[model samples]
Target chain A: MEELLANPYVGPLVLTVAIILVFPLIVGYMVLAERKVLADLQVRLGPMRVGPYGVLQPLADALKLLLKEDIIPARADKWIFWLAPVLSVFTGLTALAVLPLSDRLYVADVNIGILFILAMSSIGALGLILGGWSANSKYSLMGSLRAAAQMVSYEVPLGFATVTAIMCAGTLSMQGVIDSQFERGVWGAFDNYGLMLIPTVLFIIAGTAETNRAPFDLPEAESELVAGFHTEYSGFRWSLFFLAEYAAIVVISALCVTLFFGGWLRPFPNVELLEIPFNTVFPAGLCLLIAFGCLKGVGKQVVPGFRFLMAAIAAAFLGAAGLFVLPLTNELVIGLFWFAFKLGVMVYLFIWYRGTFPRFRYDQLMDVGWKWLIPISMAGLVLNGAVQLLARG
Target chain B: MLIDQVLFYVLAVLILGSAVMTITRRNVVYSAVWLISTLVGVAGIFLLQGAEFLAGVQVIVYIGGIMVLFLFVIMLVPLEEEASQRRFSNQKWLALATGLAVLAMLAVIVVRGIGSLDHPGPAPPPGPASLTQNSEAVGRVLFTEYLLPFELASILLLVAIIGAIVMSKARRRQTES
Candidate 1:
């Protein structure tokens, strides 16, 4: 197993499959989760008819989108019109490649992971610009222009916020940042420098703007621009736009997890209890460890079948361990519990933003991005740098 | 070694293709985009060469700042069909000849350079020493060894900014008059 992990091709290949398969699934369900939450908030039931309590709503939506007719406007440039959604979806997915979900999980943990993510995000804006321009509609054109300006403005602060993490962690690798947070003894805003209260708040705000979530979702303000850059798109093509937006939300959320939330890290780093007795006596500890290794291996295969098998196996093991293994694997159980809890909180906040806030006016979006978020994030970066220097001194 | 090969091929294709597209594209906006691709490719080349600070500066200065200015200009320019056509004169033959000559020279230099190289040169020592040493050395040399040239570059940038402002103001006055 160690030998397999040590294999150069095997590690990266597995990471790539895990990223591609898992991220979109998370995004798809997140869409359903948001709908349900919003529906409940507005005193309505959301997709109750779809598989038991709407568990299958996302799948149903996916099938509906797949069967929908793809449309192209009469005046649109056919080539660019086709290319735009592809670009948007491609760039949106590209971010997942650099994001680290766990210590050993990332498609490609580049030395310049943050910069690569930022660059890929800017490419998504290019798709919006092209989509709007090719449509040849006034509303679409205005939406695209506003989106481009908004993204460009917010990107500055987003970059600054990212630089704060990079400076504090002293590494550009997403995994490294998470490891730093874990090594510091806590997760999220509770980590180093006596808690990252200010910086994390700044990062969350900047991240919201960067992903164009509500209160900053000027690009797709339905009341103003009638669906913004995709005003002329319909059916599967329109669904592609929604896919890109939701995927962006997931990517940014994962980034927030990595940068500030100690991604996939259990809450307390010093709490590992070595079970020498269980390993020698019951041997389930060793088997559980082997199961984990297998999950990592199978997860890398990038096939849906393997991924489902891996998840099911993990769940089965946890369920079967109720009698003898529960006492032995308490720390491991707790660790997994904390990890899931953290991810759930982050996911809830993403949906909460969608449900609560109204979309920003285009000018307000630009102003907050340029005037407030950017400066505050820059100040955070400076403060973080100074803190690091002082700590070293 | 595999990463190096991939980076080399990707950067080479990006730089060459985008450079060609920059001139070949008739639309001013497309040309600006091609220019951005060219600049981004150069940044990638810097990364391939293990120059991280240089790569960051390349993106920040060229892509983030300068390209925005270029895009603003392109957007403001009224590139009507007649104006676009008038901008290009009947100098295709001359341009092609010049381009071919430059390409031939570049090919010869590259071929000669490859032929002169030793296979699998000694690997440098790894870790932060190798990574930071070069950048720190360059910084020292830049600040002290080549301070005059560095100062001159800043002065040149200042002059360009002032000249741009003057040109725009003059144009505005002329339009008003």
Candidate 2:
């Protein structure tokens, strides 16, 4: 089993399946998370009846969507119409190929991982463009056009910001960038300056715009375009579009964790304490001990002969001792915990933004992408170059 | 030997099929998509030739950027179904004959070129860095040795931008006037 897990193809295939199965669940709960956060901010009670603190809301929403009737507009271009949502979902999934959730966990560690991500994301705008155009509705067409223009404009600044990070790290590989941060014991964006300063702030702003989050979601301004490009879509198709949107938010969050935060790197500088687990095979021993304890307990319950109950009690005590020794295990488990914590912070920020900000107007959105973001990203690139040069000198 | 031949034939068929579709498709948008497929096939050929950077750039610049602009233009055009179907009758046969003759001539030239390269020569040096470094290397070289040409390209882009704005704005003025 250990050898199987270590196989290259097996790991990616397993991770892919896991991501596919887990993402919808995450998205469902994220909806609840969003509502709860928003309700807290607005001083109102969120959903409570369905499940404890509205835990079952996402499942109910999924059921509703599953039961809804699918609709296709009469005048829609049928071929492109079918292709658009598929393309959106496919592009979102492809971006996951490079995302590293933990130190040794990733789908493919391509040398040009960053470029691969950018290229895949470039295809996503096509989904919006085709969705609107194929619908043959004036409103849908306008919304899609706005989406295309907004994405194109924002992508430049986003790419520039990414280039700034890449230049500073001197590598296009995501793992390489993360490892650089780990080596320094500081997040890449905060290595020189303090937190909430220049380039990091620029990255966050650009990332938000790139993902079409609040204050930048001009494409789907509900009041104006009636849910924008996917307005004509219904049921499963519309759900797919929502899935793509949420997935995109998740991708950007993961990227922020990998690029700006020390991905899977423990916050503390010294890792000597963390490495203590490597000295002993505690987990393996614990697993064997637990199995023996389980068998003894079962034997005690089924057969009341030879004082089995007392022997089982002793076995349980030994298993509990093994459990207590888990902290003395390896850096691998600690690294996984640190990675999850960083990703959680990034995910929390996405929810925070959704709850706090209002959507931007079309003109204001364009102005931010062009006037503000582009200039800042360009300046950030220059700053990164200067820093690198000075460091070398 | 059979596998190699099959691979070559398959790529050739795809290249030809997409090129034909690009020209023959009545819908401008569909034609643009067909053109993208043709570009993708060309990138595949580049990959076969060990020109990974060239293949990537072909996809990025032609398929991703330029074809996107083509799609935009096609979408912007107020082309009706009847107007799209109307063919120019003035030089239809003449144009077809000329096109076929040119194709035949190019095929002959290509065959002759291939025949002359029967003997394999020394291989080219390994590529400088991986495919990922292509853009960075090109940027460095262009900004240093080819600085003048790089500046010229920028100027050309500027002019095109100005020209596009002028053309679009001129139409508005004409409508108003």
Candidate 3:
């Protein structure tokens, strides 16, 4: 078993399978989180009926989607329509292969790691474009047209911003970027007298546009386009598109964290005095805090089932905190904890953007992508490049 | 060794088959999709050759950037009339002549290099260690050995982009006036 585990190919293969299986659950919970967060921002209780605070809402949603009748428009280009959602989901998940979750945990450490993600995103664009065009509906076609133009325009700034990170790291590999950050004893966002923040901000904006989240979600402007490209899609097919969107959201957030944040490294990684507390205690304490929140909610629940569920969740979080403190699991959990923590923060920012901002007008979206983002990102690139050169000299 | 050969042949077949389908499709959108498949197959071949950076650039620039533009153009055009019109059916002889010329050129190149197949040069040191350095090697050569040509290519692409914008702007002005 040890020999098998040591085989490089076997390890990555197992990791690949694990990511594929686990990511959907993560994405599902992310959807619930988005709803819950959006609800909180709107000052309301959201989906309290499904599970304790709608914890099982994603599972219920998944079952409903799975059991619903799949529909394809009669006039649609059947093959392309069928292929679109699969393409979206496939490219979204495939991009995960290059995402270095930690130094030790990743599927494949390809030399062109970031570029691979970029390429997958480009293909993911194809899924949207094709889905829109194939639907044979006017709205679908218009949505796709917007998607193609928007993605193409936003990608310019996104590429330039990524170039900024790549230049700082002097490598395209994701793991290499984090290692360089560690070596420099600063996150990419904090590098070069904080000039790197320009690209960091540009990346977040461009990434938001790239993923078609508000205020840049012109392609799927529900009020105008009636659900946009997936208008003709229903049931299982629509769910696939939803899955792909959330998967993309997660992937882009992970990319943002990996590029600007210190990735799996704890904040202030080189501060030896704080290392034990930050690495070991902080993670467990965070979980315990969440458990405490759950415990507080247990007394307020009117339903016995809801109260029991709340307590059970509190227990689960307590157990998780327990695992974090255990000697055997401490080191194993630390890296994943930091990575997920950073990732969660980024994901929350996305949800926050959605709740706060109104959608951009179509022309306004194009203006932002071209008139603002591209030039700013380009300038950021040149500035960071100059700073790096001078620092090296 | 066996897996490498198998992957190579599989990718080659996919590339060739998809290229054929790309031309044969009646629907322009279908043709565009097939072209993407062909590009992806080519990218797979590049990956199989251990040129990871080249493989990535192939997918990014070709399949991602170029092909999306192609699809956008194809969709913007009214294809129903074009589909009804005879394409290669009318230009069969001209097509055949051009195809033969290209085939002859390729054949000549292949024949010239055929001798090396039996005594092919040593493969690049194949392992994960060397594989991970593929992009570094590419970056070094591109920036140092072929820097001028690379810059020239970028300038040329810039010129094309500007020319396209100018031409489109000119047409829009004509329509407005």
Candidate 4:
């Protein structure tokens, strides 16, 4: 048992398990962050009553969702309805298996990592369509139809954009793409005197659509479809859909950071002058700053138990921060720290988008995807290919 | 090795069972769902064979794109009308006999082929590294050896797209004139 425990693979296996376990919790807190950020944007206090500026809101929400009665409508296709959310959650979580979080972190190091990701995410679309159809409601059907149309249309541009990056990197492996970027001393977006800029922009726009976030969220537009595909889903089942959506958002943002922002790489990673400070001070300072913010929130908290919980979280962050100050942990945390930092920015962009943009009309959404994004991305891909060819010549 | 054998058998059974279920399902939607499961089973088999890229493409294109299109068409069909249609009342004994004969022929082929397939005389067992390198190796051959076929296939697809647009536009022009 001890020998088995000491095995090198055991460490990564355990960590991967921990990541899977922790994913839902992180997703739950992301909901909290979105609520807080959106509220700030709209000039509201948000869930102020839920333990120190709504810090405990996600936990509360989870408890409520778990306790609430799950309903399957009398007319609903029970098997497919039950299967839909399972499909959603399954695809969402499985895509995480191939994601290279840091150098040492990842569940599997698949050669066709991006292809695997694309496959899983595309399958996720089936969940939404099936859920909507199984509901047997007109609104649900319409919403799902819109979603299916949107996803299928947007995927073209998204593929083109990804292909553009694959061309730049000359490898399909997620880590290889990152390593290529590091070796070239430029992110995929800034390659060839900003030639890849168009595709990067195209990817973000299409990725936003692909995730069904706002501006592209015609499927679930409350004004039209009355909550869209999952309209008939209730309680725990509904929360499964919510969890899947947020997890998918995380997957997309993580991919974005890996592809465009440089996976696990700090600013100017190759620069000898900036390397030492960035490697040490940046991670330590960032973690400490996050810890400080959490600690600051504890002061404004109301309930004693909530405050205590917040304090514990703060301490954990502080401990992580403290680890970074030392040489051993500094090396360990830098990869993760930079990766998380970039991913956090991408996630923030998602919330900021939701707050600012109005939902696109169905036709308009289709027009943008088909007529505009697709052509632009295809042109960008061709142009980049030409540039690379010319440069080589 | 034992686990791999077990998994292969399980997926084989699933593929066959799902194929039967897909055709037998009274509801079109259920049939489509089963068809998807069958496709997924095939993808699983591909994965087991270490054709990981092929597996991904199977899911992406067949299950994702084509299956979605199938579902769309199925959804447009009037369910009430479809539900009332006689499902298995054709009573075509010749059709059933032909199907059985085909199955028998396939069984015979498989039984005959299985003995010869075990030994690829000179080639060693392709391991995990070969599995990971599957796509790159395939791409290399495809671009070099089958370059003509590959380019021709793409040109054909491009022509089809242009033909579709031209046909649509011609109809619109006639309507306007």
Candidate 5:
């Protein structure tokens, strides 16, 4: 019994289960954050009717979606229609199983980790296409077609850009890529005399398109496609699509961090004398600051019940901060801290793009992806390859 | 070991069953989706063999890109008119004869080669486990030993693209004139 309990797989299995249970909640709040941030950007109050600052808005939304009646079109292909959202959610979540959050906190460390992630995400395009076609609505058909076309076009540049980084790192494993970055004392983004940054930028652009975010979200341009492929879907099915989208957003952002930013490695990690303080104090300080802000919100709130929730949230943050500062807990928790921090920053950029950019017309989206991004990324790949050869030689 | 065998049989069954369904389905859209299932099952088989990189490539290139194209074609073709046809058409028997002949020849070669293949060498240096560095090993082989064929393949593709463009351009000019 002890041997079974002490097995190496046991801890990671528990972590995997914890992640599976908690990931949707994190993704749920991501939606809230996006709404709030976009609202702030547009000078509007977002979701204030729920708990404090609409903090409980996602919970309410989930309840409502769960309770709402689901409707399937009478002529729709029943099996494929039902399969689409499940496939979307599955593909999005499967990518999570391979991503390295921190040094020690991924579900599985596959040999071709990055490649596995890319393949799974690309397969997500199939879900969109299938969903649209099976819906028996012209709008759904058009939307899914556009999504498939856009996703495939962007994938080429995305692959080339990833090739550039893999060339720089000389590895394909996600963890190995980060370790190579740390060994070289430079992030992959800033490598190869700043040439790799081209691929990094291309990656970010193609990633935005791949995930069907604004400026590249012609597939679901609400004015044109009426909610796109999911227009015919209702209630829980619709929520599944929404959840899959946000989960995909989280996956893409987390991946960008793992690829370009240093995964779980603090900035300037190679500076040996400063490393300990830099790694230890930074997370502790950030958590404490978050707790302070949450606590500060409690005093400003008007309602007692909402204030109590804020107090609870503030306490949670404080406790997390305490965990980060404590020696044993610090070691256990700090990896998660850095990974989440970088992921949060990447997600912030995603929200920032949504706020700033207008939707790209279909022709322009294809032109940018095919005529511009792919060629530039190819050149970046060649440039990185040459640099790698020369540097080694 | 037991788990691996179980997974292999499961995925192999899935692949073969879906492949049969893919060809036998009357609906083109259904056929394409079944083809996707077959491709995914094949990828699962690769994963079972510990060829992680190969499995990823199979899914990405075949299922993701090519299957989408297949769906596009299926959508374009007017399938309603030809949804149901005579099951055992006259030409099908002739095709079956040719297919069986080819299969029989291949089977004979495989059956004869089995013993020699089993003990061809003392032992190979790398088994599937050491295929952990799958991509690296593949790159090394391609760049060093197979570099000429690889480069030639790219050149062939580029030539085909140019040929296609020239033909299309000539047709457009003729139409305009």
Candidate 6:
């Protein structure tokens, strides 16, 4: 067992399995969180039926999707239809392999890390295109056509934005990017007299569009395209596409966090006085506060079973808080906590945009992607490159 | 060592098999999809050779960018008519002869190329040092030795882009008039 643990390959292999298993659950909870956030924005209770505020909703959804009758359009290309969702999920999950979850936690620190992610995403786009094309419906074809065009267009600005960070960091590896930010004593977004903020903003905007979220979600604009590329998909097959979309969102959020927000580094990482507070006090306090909120909700549940479930959840949160301050585990989980915190912030921003913004018209989407984002990102890349050169000199 | 050999053979079979499927597929979209698999296989080969950057670029440029555009164009073509058409041209024999001639030329080149090598049993696996420095080494050589050629290539691409835009605008204007 010790030997197996010591083996270099075993660690990554285990991490890979863990991520493949745990990621879907994370994505499921993220969906619940999105619904809750969107509900809060609109002033309503989002989902309250399943397990005290719909905590078990994702699992129920998964089970229902699994047991539901699978349907394929009569005219759909049998092989390609079967292949598409699998392709989407595969590429989405594969991109996670290179993500530097923490300094000590990751699958593989490959040389071409960020490029691997970008390439995987590009292939994921193929899955969308193929899914739409194979569906044999006019709406599906149109949705896919829009998907291909939008991904290709936004990729330009996304590439340029990423290039700015790559230039500043001078390395393609994910861990190296974080370490460089640590060494520089600032996040990539705060570098270059705040000029780096241009790419930071560009990255976020293009990333949102790239993921086909609202205001840029012409491909899947429900009123028009009728659920977009996966219009004909149903049951487990449809859920796979849904899983891929959420997975892509998480991947993008992770990328944004890793590139700009400093992957695992706490804010003001070099400040000695801030370290203990940010590392220990902040995380523990936040968990305790959430636990307290959960505890307060227990009295509101009239049913004994529901109230007990609420208390159990609050107890779980309290245990989590306790784990945060525990000497051994605290050191281990600190990096992961900050990375997750920043990632959650990015994910929340995505949900917030979905709630706040109206969907873009197709032509308007193209216009924004081409005219505004592309040019700004290009100029930002050049300016950041010049700043880095001057700073080096 | 055994795993490396097995992986190489697997990738080779994948590339060759998909290349054949690409040309043989009746539907244009299927052909394009098959060609993507072939490109992915080639990228795998590049990775096996320890050229991670090249593998990534191959996927990004060929399968991701170029093939997506190809599919867009393919969508306009009526696949029903394409599949209904004859599989082979009238000049199949002539084409076969020409293909064989080209194969002969390639074989000759390979034979002569191998003769020039000092000690080549597939050229030993690259050392760890070279594997890690692959990208940096490529960048250094590209910026120094082949700098002018690299710049020229970029210029050529820029020219192509401008020419395409000009042609597109002209056609659009003619249609409007």
For each of the candidates, what fraction of the native contacts does it recover? 0.00, 0.05, 0.54, 0.39, 0.46, 0.46
Most accurate candidate by DockQ? 3
Backbone clash pairs for candidate 2 read A277-A329, A277-A330
lDDT measured at residue B126 in model 6 versus the true structure, 0 to 100:
43
Residue lDDT tens for model 2, B114-171: 9768886655344222334544665678789999988999999999999999999999
Off by over 4 Å in 6: B87-102, B115-131
DockQ, candidate no. 6: 0.50
Interface RMSD, prediction 6: 3.1
| DockQ (CA atoms), all models | 0.17, 0.22, 0.60, 0.46, 0.47, 0.50
lDDT of each: 0.70, 0.72, 0.89, 0.86, 0.85, 0.90
Runs in model 1 with CA error above 4 Å? A1-6, A186-196, A271-343, B1-14, B32-84, B89-116, B119-177
Between prediction 4 and prediction 5, the one with superior TM-score is 5
> Which regions in candidate 5 have their CA more than 4 angstroms from the true location?
B82-94, B116-131, B171-177
Clash pairs, candidate 6, are: none
Candidate 4 chain B, poorest ten consecutive residues by summed lDDT: B122-131
Rank candidates, DockQ, best first: 3, 6, 5, 4, 2, 1
What C-alpha RMSD separates each model from the true structure?
7.8, 7.8, 1.7, 2.8, 2.5, 2.1
What order do you get sorting by lDDT, best first?
Answer: 6, 3, 4, 5, 2, 1
Candidate 4 on A99-165: residue-level lDDT in tens? 8888878767777888889999988989999999999998889878887888889889989999898
Look at candidate 5 and tell me the lDDT of residue B175: 100
The TM-score measured for candidate 6 stands at: 0.96
Q: What is the TM-score of each candidate against the true structure?
A: 0.76, 0.79, 0.97, 0.93, 0.94, 0.96
**Which scores higher on lDDT, 1 or 5?**
5
Put down candidate 3 lDDT per residue, B47-162, tens digits, no spaces: 88778789888998987788889888888887788899886766889989999999999999999999889996767675552436888898889999999999999999999999
Per-residue CA lDDT of model 3 for A2-82, tens digit only, reads: 999877689888888998898888888999999999999999988777977789999999899889988888889999999
Cα displacement (angstroms), candidate 4, residue A345, comes to: 0.6
